[model samples]
Target: MPEVKNEHIKAILAIVPEKPGCYQYFDEKGTIIYVGKAKNLKRRVHSYFNKEQDSNKTKVLVKQIRDIKYIVVDTEEDALLLENNLIKQYRPRYNVLLKDDKTYPCIVIKNEYFPRVFQTRNIIKDGSKYYGPFSSVFMAKTMLQMLRELFPLRTCKLPLTPESIANGNYKVCLEYHIKRCLGPCQGLQTREDYDKNIRIIKEILKGNIAQVSNYLYEEMQQLASNLKFEEAQKIKEKYDIIENYRGKSTIVNHSLTNIDVFSFDETDSSAYINYLHVNNGSIVQGYTFEYKKRLDEAKEELLGLAITEMRTRFNSLAREVIVPFLPDVDMSSTVTFTIPLKGDKRKLLDLSKQNVKQYKLDQLKQAEKLNPEQRTTRVLTTMQHDLQLHALPVHIECFDNSNIQGTNPVASCVVFKMAKPSKKDYRHFHIKTVVGPDDFASMNEVVYRRYRRLLDEEEPLPQLIVIDGGKGQLNAAVDALRSLDLIGKIAIIGIAKRLEELYYPDDPIPLVLDKNSETLKVIQRLRDEAHRFGITFHRSLRSKKQVLSELDSIKGIGEKTKVALLSHFKSVKRIREADQEEIWKVVGVAKGNLVIAGLKQASDKIKESKEK
Candidate 1:
């Protein structure tokens, strides 16, 4: 703003009063750029121009400020709340913007005689009843499904009146045949029965499930007494289903009637709130929401704004509210707020707190996914905790032995940097020092060769080493580290495939971590990767060795001839399948007949075995 450094702003700053208040900054175009609150308006407003701001955003905000406005409040909380309202109304440029204007889910009873009970997001000004602004849409749908099962309410969208039914304006569909509906549209069910079911549904929606359950139980018993076993069984199924859903959803198991519960957690630029609507002994609605803080507003101020917005948006008319604390807002005479000190109400608040905290954690994890370094740090930290290691495994190496029936033994060392496979850093060992399919010996040799090179070359070593085997392999790998006087410098553990048991050297008992733990998953990933790498290399060697042995068995294929035939045909199977002329060309004419005859003899033996 050209007038940012002008006399008017300076004069206003000079005359700014000392009081708790909200302030707004305007740019050259007369657009509000930022809004802020402070206990002492003069000092807070003056500090912006007097001190150098560290944040680029703040500095830019000051540079654009051509004019300022203020509103004084009696208390600091009032200043906070006023700031929130101003920022939201103007959506000031420098404010932290809430991207999700979250709308809650509510079960709406449509105004029709046969009211449609289903979840809706908005409360339209139609003559209808809304039960809850539920915290979860899934919870609302689940409740609706249970209610449908119990009442067999109409699913069709037809306007059924006495006159329409008398004129035969509707036909009953498959809902009646399947016993899912009482055919209210076609007058197979009376208005009284349908209205009665609707009333019962409303009662249940208001957390009066016990009354409905008792009525259903008594009805089921009456039907069973009349030998209507099929109908009785259907009623019993619904009884189980409704009770099961109630048992799962009702956390505290007792009712808190007509109350709204709010719990919160905060982040750098946001406040998160979990809202639960309790009626009778059940939570009928739940929702977690976030509000952006403009000008670094206090939690209390942000929370008040969120509560007002949510209540207005959801049309909540609960007489009582359970909150973490009383917000700085004018209260209506009809509504009272409570901060529970003990018992079930306290439990409900805690549940809401836990929800918002978890929601905040989830948001952080989502951000971490976009940042590789953050994800790496998280994984390493988790690994350290789960494995009880002294340090983070910034660089991790896992070893797996691969050999089949005492032949072509090999081991692989797979390296991971920040919980991700570092393919170029991976190493394959040919097991030169170990004879036979000795996995333990192979592990020892590979470990020795790996760290010994790192030691000689003055390269950094991994903080953790994983051996893909049970205790024996772990001991063998540890011995190699011990040989280099580096056992204590690094952490090593072994994973057994069968049970995924983790073994530490010199410890008799293995540590079993939860299957879902992040640390255990990382270890499992490293182990599986090592096994795959080693098995690939081992299979290649075995295939080459087998081909060499088979080609060497051919009578005319001497060492040089064998090499020529192998190179040309690639394998014994290829040589066997080749035309005699092709074989003659590779082995030469003089020895071609002998080679063909030997091949025929082998083929005959294989055919005879299969025939038997």
Candidate 2:
């Protein structure tokens, strides 16, 4: 960390106000070094000079600062928009600059008479109608192709003036012969007919294909009522084509007008935002980009700047913007900022967030393809942040208790290493000294037993321990840790099955993790595995007791032979599956004969009893 030695820096910092606004940092020769938005200008701008920075980049940025400038806004959102505007104007060295962001494909209906409809990547100032900056080029192309199939339009470069066509100077091309185009070149197609086709194409391009389909459907019904069967059939085909195109679109609503959706993610050094431009309920364009921060930037600030740049780049006039946060921007009066709690808008925001995160993950996966350890390291790092854990929980364990009807109670512990299950390390425990299916006691005994043995044998312990229950089971495990003098040495949590909420020690409010977060997924997996292991052990015990009860009535089959039979065959069902020779090998001839006869008499008596 370094300090700004210039006298101009101190005078500027002294007057910075506690207001929401955009701030700029300038270096030697009055070049803007960074642009930022802050809720409180004084606290945000002066913090750079007051505190020691851990990021070397931040330290360097602060040392180079010569003067500060700020423009106050009405709200944080205003600051966001202003900061972005200045960043674009100055392209400050310390600001995050997005490179290689996509400009999505759009359907352009040319302004010329007998206009051509096609897909384009550029938006021109020409008097043409543009629809979509489609989320996918494939989707845009599909719509265009479907339109061409439904209505054969001209793709020619001919100047088909009415006088020239009336003079009969132009000839019909191969397209007209193949029925793929109307022969407007030679006035064979009327201007009225060509313009009608162009109007329908406009509707389809504007994501209003459903309206066209419904209208055609009504027309088909009217024609059919008049007994014009061929006319009805033709209308039906056009209706079906429009309906199919509408069905394939990812549009969520037909009522929604032009809007922009923004979602963002931040790593230590960079921020990524996904932008979706929605027009009349369909996503016209979707783009995601990563911005590498030359200075430490907040997630909100980065997202705000990104939104401004994206909207400006696309020439967007969208008044309503959907975002995860109310950016520090000055659009309070002129534009609407919607932070959707729930609905189609929230879903759209979530979709954008997923896109940005996946885009970032794809970049990482490409860089770390050959080395799997990099992925684990990243996951562990994420878990550490999400859980607020003291250390990365690379080695974690979970315990679960299973019991039914207060009999054959059992517990099991499952371990995970580097976020993957360690099956061989899983252990099942018989509930000892605990009566009447006390889950708390069962959990306590297992935790005490498992960790005590580990300490006695000097086995490596897990960084985190998960209990598959609510607060009671969690506290029981905590008690065991305390008794072992390892309370703070290991981190412990409980997962309540009802809401999947995480319970920590002495904390009143359970930590609510995002459902999509890797930390929650890993903890849930561990809890499920422990339950599976415990239930399997409990079922085995119940089956053993059932077999013992039925076979104990046999007088001649001694306890030694009972053990031998179970040990040899593993279960009573397998013992019953054996033939006389199979039993003979295990118990010797005389005892095997006695055992078979005794089992046969018991079976007969049970059948007779049931029949009676």
Candidate that would win on lDDT = 2
Task: Residues 1-612, candidate 2: write the lDDT tens digits.
Answer: 346577667656655667776787888899989988899998998888888888899989987887776654445643554454456557788788421233456678777767888888776758777765454678778878888888888888776677788899889889999998988888778889999888887777655667787778898999999999999998898888887764322333334668999988877777878887776444545567889999987777887798789988988899999999988667777679999997558766876776676657655654455577887888888988988889899999999999998888889999999999999999999888898979998899999999999999999999999999999999999998999999889999999999999999999899989999888998999998898898988898887678786567767778999999989998766776689899999988888888777777777888999999
lDDT per residue, candidate 1, 1-612, as tens digits? 122367767767765667776788999999988888899988999988887788998888888889886654445644554454456557888888421344446687888977778888676757677765454677778888888877888878898778998889988999899988988887889889888988988777766678878988998999999999999998899788757755222232223567888888886667888876765434445567677777888777777777787788778898888889988666668779899997568767876676576556655655565575876777788788888889888899999988889888888999998899999999998889877878778888999999999999999999999999999999999999999999789999999888888999999999998899888899999998998999999888887777676555667568888778778987778887889999888777878777778778877888999999
What clash pairs does model 1 have? 134-285, 134-286, 135-285, 135-286, 135-287, 254-281, 255-280, 255-281
RMSD, each candidate, Å? 16.0, 17.1
CA RMSD (A), model 1 = 16.0
What lDDT would candidate 2 get against the real structure?
0.80
Q: What RMSD does model 2 have?
A: 17.1
Worst 10 residues of 1 by lDDT: 246-255
